[model samples]
Target: MSSVKYSTRVNSFALGKGKKLPTGNEPILELIALAGTVPGLTSLELNYPEHFKHDSLEDIKEAIEKAGLDVPALQLRWPSPRFSNGAFTNADAEIRAEAVQMVTEAIDLCASFGADHVLLWPAHDGYEYPLQMDYTKSWVWMVQGLQAVADHNPAIRVSIEYKPADPRGRTILNTTGAVMNLISDTNRANVGVTLDFGHLLMARENPAQSAAMCLQAGKLFGLQLNDSHGVADDGLMVGSIHLAETIELAYYLIREGYAGTYYFDTDPVRENPVEECGMNIVRMGAIIEMARLLVRNHPNLPTGRALDSAPILWETVMGGKWNTTVSV
Candidate 1:
């Protein structure tokens, strides 16, 4: 609506949850092909290992090209069967080294694909109960492991994706602030974050405010757009549940200089993945339209040297809803 185009990316596996409903098991090439059919999808965030059918990068690259998409980033899911316990901050030194090696290898793979970023989600890197592990040692090992990965190559951006808790009760690097701390400890400019909206909702952080804060800290490197009930990660379509929050998030993102794509992480379990993803793009566009309308009607909402109050923002957003007599 503002004449500003917002590009979109979909995680390769996200396109066909029905193929393995509630979870995804679609083949890499098929997923790529299906996602490409989605009108607005510009790129993909691939999960390493799973998404790689064979060692032949050419095979995958050719398939992706044939599908009409680009590989912008790769997600390094640390809780795979190979990394059952954890990756970055695993207690065992040997396992930790393997984890670091995996990340470095993924970075090289990303380079091969001409992708600029790698998403590191440490899904199982924390303990479920108290006294089950030594917090100090784990945190130290985690920091060192991350540093090792960051030090591998300064050219490739390593974006850490944080979750409050899911695969682990007390997931390491679980919050935005905690992730920011880890980025600080990593001491690499290329090390930033992939802020997932569903994870933010589960963490009880205002997605809009979190985007603003993370952008301010210069740590918001990537974004995953999805929705949840705030109770669990439903992976519902983006605008299905949290309309206001999603719109506000778009407002902040558009207000800031978010030039990256909104990577779709939705679970289209009973729906057509291609149709659902296209719908997600359209939904995000509607939200962006709301943001555009709010700013258009109340021009002062975003024109300031400092952040506006929450009430001011909510009021402006609420004001966008109107019933005209002509409509009746």
Candidate 2:
């Protein structure tokens, strides 16, 4: 099997551009230019806040062209009133409508930039107290809001990212199961799931298992590549933890014929952005290399049933020493 290509979220490199830079220079373009220089990078992911301020879609498109990179995906993380602070699942109908409008605008922007997908992480749209909110009402609100966005732009794909509570409390769609349920309820062809490996680790879901489940459900629209300490969403370099599991997950993707972009969704808040991103790229390349070796070494590896029972197969291949030591 050939190596899986990788992409980087521009937010991961914004801090490295220097703190004194003006906002108008467009950091997303700068990050794309950087990633374009990376040998195996096939695309780039741009978050909303970095490029949403551009006056027109043509400007954003021009920046991407100038950077020599394509925007494979776009994320809506800002315009705080619409996304953050529980606007999508707010109790008020007007608030929900506004949130839908914000996302619709984002979808339009995605179309303009030729982005393949739009990512929505409903992190803040959840309850902080048990009895303070109504579960049924919140689900209804979220579905309605998301439907509005989907209906507005059927051409662009929208992916809901699942993240368990951490810097916050009880996100609505905190698990892969919950996200799957949302996709079933919404029943939109253009709406799917964004599997973030770190978030799955934080949720205590086996990353390989989660990937298999999403693949089975036909909801795996995109992937966020990052490593975690199995506790918090560390966003460290790939293969930092769960080394064998990461390799197995890559094998699964290869078996399932997943052709979507693999995005590195780490944070640059606490570390040197460029250095960390470069390390992440190198680690990911190594992981892909290992996956290729696994496939080559096990020429007759299972398909269907054998692939479904991959945990046992993987354990047998590793001689039950998959977790014996940490790599990083």
Candidate 3:
């Protein structure tokens, strides 16, 4: 089995899968304790402003320590209702500046926790209709905003998480290619991507291919592992909906020697959060192990042509043995 570092969304514990919120005064602490109960859960990825709303960072850190969990990353959350127009690309100049400031604050918070990076999901930074947004100027503003955030803290990284559309008609960085381009344009070494599997699926992208691209580009900062039906950010557990793709992605991540943490950005609306997260860790480990087995069983499985390797691939994956071969 691969020695993988597992983390999960802390809010999942308190959200109660939309059933009920934690009644405690310090819900963040309670949530941390609940999340820590999951075996093999190595660390946590928490939100900045939202998670800090009730408890102080000191209290949260103390609770995390008590739970034997490390804070690996702090996600910046800017709800759409507050910035429906956009975030970095908001039409109002002050709101854009405020968004940038919020990112800088999140960076500071991340540094305080010795976290790797701040996950920035530009959820509200897109457009609704054609001509509803000023393409060129908005792009410029985005670059400028990102540049400002990068300049705020050169030592810390800022990983951009992209989504195709939701809470908005279309997001600014909707695709992996677009995110790569943004990173290129931002011209900042610390700016990278936190590839969400479901978001990639929604964009009609193959997660394995995107992982390979990001890994090769050296901009693959982290991964938000989850699944969906290629339509929304369903945030389902890994392998629940896209098992093969998850396995393939794991294969590529292993092949590429990715050493970053796997954050379970999932939603356990109806299931126990702790159990669901524990299952996620187990499923990913199994997928990674199976990927290793596949590579070992067939050295030339991905032979640049799907038809050329489909037979042995299926045999090993389905039959658990490479007993047959096809040359064509």
Local distance difference test, each candidate: 0.76, 0.74, 0.86
Cα error of candidate 3 at position 211, Å: 0.9
Best by lDDT: 3
- Candidate 1 per-residue lDDT over residues 103-203, each given as its tens digit: 99899999988877888888888778878867778888878887888888889999888999887787877678888887887788889988998999888
* CA lDDT for candidate 1: 0.76
Cand. 3 TM to true fold: 0.93
**CA RMSD of each candidate after superposition:** 4.2, 5.1, 2.8
State every prediction's TM-score relative to the real structure.
0.86, 0.83, 0.93
Give the per-residue Cα lDDT of candidate 1 at 274: 77
Candidate 1, residue 86: lDDT: 77
- After superposing candidate 3 on the true structure, give the runs of residues whose Cα lies further than 4 Å from its correct spot: 16-26, 322-328
* Residue 233, model 1: Cα distance from true site in angstroms: 1.1
Q: In candidate 3, how many clashes are counted?
A: 0
Q: Which stretches of candidate 2 lie over 4 Å from their true place?
A: 1-4, 16-32, 54-56, 81-84, 268-272, 296-328
Per-candidate clash tally: 0, 0, 0
